[model samples]
Target chain A: MPLKLFELVGRDAARPFSPYCWRTRMALAHKGLSADTIPWRFTEKSVLVPYGSERVPVMLDGDRAVVDSWAIANHLEDAYPDRQSLFGGAGGRAMARFINSWGDIAILGGISPLVLADIPKLLDQVDADYFRTSREARFGKPLEEVMATRDQAVIGFRRSLEPLRQTLKAQPFIGGDAPDYADYIVFGGFQWARVVSPFKLLEETDSVYAWRERLLDAFDGLARKSPGFPV
Target chain B: MPLKLFELVGRDAARPFSPYCWRTRMALAHKGLSADTIPWRFTEKSVLVPYGSERVPVMLDGDRAVVDSWAIANHLEDAYPDRQSLFGGAGGRAMARFINSWGDIAILGGISPLVLADIPKLLDQVDADYFRTSREARFGKPLEEVMATRDQAVIGFRRSLEPLRQTLKAQPFIGGDAPDYADYIVFGGFQWARVVSPFKLLEETDSVYAWRERLLDAFDGLARKSPGFPV
Candidate 1:
């Protein structure tokens, strides 16, 4: 049986845009495997009840069901030992945990305010309503207001990426000579931002921008082939 | 001949306290190797001219000289392969680079304002003058002014460590169950802070505080045994 993945989508089921989901997508591609996408939406919580998860990016591999992006990545690596390794070795796996934390905070959290308001426009009416209400409650303000100063806030967002920029100065990928799960952990956020918002999160001259372009070209341009803005 | 490391010190030559040097110190101890310390002061740049570095932590192993903490760590790993691996594997070596960057910025750079002023007090008159002149020029203010609001600014420094705190929630060490070079990368900074400052950088309730305690106890209390402020 082919692997199946529950992935997040908006108005267009073809464009799966959750950063966590993107991590799994890249991992599967890196392993030279494919998963049949079970397109999911924000309001479709009941559909995921069988999978025991309230979020998308849940992976179903035969009898095993894995929830959470980090868990799913580990599952893929362990389950497919014969394929290209997700982490280079035991040390890489441990160190990548730190990177995973960084990706969550610096990459995903940092990008949220810059592109959040734009996300609602891509959702259908119900998901848009659910997303706006839930997110606004989390931020304690309207999404529009939160994103109002994104033009200026992006400078700090760019600055927050200094460690990543510094890393890329010596390496072409976070995984060293080639892209690995570490690259996917971070690219997931940039890719998600690209799918939902037209905001340019990186400067063309930045090493991070060049790294993203390389990932966009990975797996036969798998991410680039998805429907999204040119950004 | 034993390996000789030129390490930064103040009036108390026995308390070698440069963060970079501490990284190499911990790494050397991890490899179960010992190096004799050549206590160095800020004004003694001309003494290190033959080593081709303007910094401390220049390690001389027999006829070979290694400079910089990161390079020294790599040198130790490669030169002493029969010992425990500094990086778990090739992937670990690559990913650790990112952690090294974060260590330099978040751990070392983050602790600077809170502890920098305390450093000059540890130095003698000549080195103290050079430290105040150079560092004040770098910060564009007196060290006292920069550190004045640190009691409040420490909250932000603590916040910057959130990612590291998140990582420790899962693994015992950044390098996994046992401490590795990655753990040493960040611990070197905390050890540096403890050596010079009385200011508390971590809340006792925080996981990071626990992690620091564990690292200090590693290699038979190598860091804890060093002379420093109680904090």
Candidate 2:
């Protein structure tokens, strides 16, 4: 049996919109591995409970189940050593931990408010209600209110990507010459925003925009083929 | 004959506190290569003009002059391949470009406001005048004003370090298990602050603070032995 991955989607099972899940998807492709997608949704907590995870990107390889995207990436790298490395090497694997954190805090955290309101439109009624309720409880506001100032907020978000911008300017990718898990970790956030919302997270003039175009075309247009708003 | 490094120093000359210079210093020590320190000051631009650059971290190895800390690091890595690797490997080296950028923007840029006011105290009158004028011209404000709200500004600065904090929390160093050029890139900023100012940049409870302490104690307390305020 092929490996199986629980990927978070919404009304359209074909669209895996979770940033964390996209990270796993890219990692699997990078490692030349394929997994049957088990489309997940916000209200699908019961299915994940059996996998001992409350999240998408739960990768089931044989008898072992990996819960987190980071864990899944590691598992893919270690298990498929003969395949292309997700992290270039041990050092990259180490530093990628920082990149993963940056993706979560700077990318995912930064882009959340910019697109959260649009996400409900992609979800079924039950999932949409669950998402709005959970997110509102967490943020103490409605999703639309949370993302109300996204136009202005996006300027700051673009500025926050300066480090990534500078790095991309001098090199083709964060992985240097080629894309790696560091690139995937960050690109996953962009993919999430693209798939669920029509927001323009990156400007056309940005080196980040160019890098994103490269990634969108990476792995035989794997990410581009997935259902998403035009970046 | 040992290698020679043009390091930025203040009036005392013993304190080399330029963040970029400190990066070269740490990289040298990591490579287990020693260099005779040639103290340079802000007004010493003419000397560096002959070096083809106006940077303090102008490293002279044999007859060739390597300017810029990043260039010097790459030179050392390629030149001394037999010694300790500054970047773990090719991937580590590549990802480090991003870390280098984060160090510049988030580390050096964030800490500037907190410590810029105090830097004049450590510089000679000539250097101080040059420093203030150039920086004021750049920022379009008096140095004190630039740094006036540091107490409140530091809260945001600390929060901005979430990525580094998260990275250190999971691993001993960005290089993992041991320190590397990536560690030096970030630590150089702290060393610069420690040498030039008395302000506390990290809280005792912070993982970043602990990581700084470990780095300070690395290479036989190399950074600790330098003239600096208690971290």
Candidate 3:
């Protein structure tokens, strides 16, 4: 049987928006593997309970279930070693973990405030309520209020990406000449922003903007074909 | 002849303290290769003129001259394929470049202000004058003035290390189970700071501190044996 992946979505099942899920999606595409997507939503924890996860990007490859995007990427790499390697070698795999941490802390965390307020608008009432209540508790304010200073906050976000920007200036992708798991790790956050929010996270002249354009066009435009804004 | 490396020092030749040179030092040790250190001081630019570069860590591997820490690493990896790998593989080699950039910008840059004032004290009168004039010009302020707010500024430096700190919490080293070039890349900055300053860059409780401790003990205390303050 083909692999099946639980991907986070909202009111529109066609739009899979979770940053972690996009990482797995791109990883699968990179390996030339296809997974049937099971659209998940914010309030759908019960759906993943049997899979031993309360998160999206949980993959079912036959009877074995892999939870978390990072785990799923590892599972895919180990299970299909004959396919193109996700990490070039042991070294790449280890360093990619650093990249993954940077992706979570720097890229995803940086983009969250800019896009948080726009997320609930695309969710169903129940999911929207769940998102707002949970997120507000985390931020100690309403989502919109958290995002009120996003215009000014984005300058810091851009500055936080200096390492990434500098790297991309010297190479075509984070993985160097070819897109690898490292590139997918960061691009997942950008793709998530594009899917849900129209906010301008990057200027067109930025090298990062150009790198994203290349990844968007990668794998026969697999990411582009997925529903997302022009960002 | 055995390999030779020109490493930056201040007054005491025993305390070679350029962050880039430390990176090459650790990389050589990782590859089980040793180079005789040619101590280069701040005012000794003429010594490197024949090497086609004005930088320390210009490695002389027999008849060949390899310049830059990154280039020296690549040279070692390529020249001694029979030895242990500096980068795990091609994928790792590519990703290490990103880590290298992060080390320079985040680790070295962040630590500069916190330890800048202490650096000149480690140098001789001639080198100290040159160092202060050059660094002050770069900062557009006196070295002491640039570091005046470092007591409070260190907070931001610690916060900037969140990604590296987070990675160390999950793994023993940035290179994962063992130290690799990626580990050396960031550790070079920490080692540089430790070599010149008594400033407390990492709290005793920080995971990064533990990671540094392990590295300090790596290669049979190669870095620790070198003259440095007890950071």
Best by DockQ: 1
DockQ of each: 0.90, 0.86, 0.84
**lDDT digits (tens) for residues A1-231 of candidate 3:** 999999999999999999999999999999999999999998889998998888888999999999999889999999999999889999999889899999999999999999999999999999999999999999999999999999999999999888888888778988889999999999999999999999999989988899999999999999999998998
- Chain B TM-scores of the candidates: 0.98, 0.98, 0.98
Candidate 1 CAPRI-style tier: high
User: What is residue A165's positional error in candidate 1, in angstroms?
Assistant: 1.0
Instruction: Pull out the clashing pairs in model 2.
Output: none
lDDT string, candidate 3, B1-231, tens digits: 899999999888889999999999999999888899898998999998999998788999989999999899999999999988888998899899899889989999999998999999989999999999999999999999999999899999898888887787778987879999999999999999999899889889988889999999999999999999997
Per-model TM-score versus the true fold: 0.99, 0.98, 0.99
Report per-prediction Cα RMSD to one decimal: 0.9, 1.0, 1.0
Highest-lDDT candidate: 1
Q: Tens digit of lDDT per residue, candidate 2, span B123-170?
A: 999999999999999999999999999989999999999998888778
**Which residue pairs show backbone clashes in model 3?**
none
Worst 10 residues of 2 chain B by lDDT: B84-93
- After best superposition, candidate 2 residue B205: deviation in angstroms? 1.4
Better of 1 and 3 by lDDT: 1
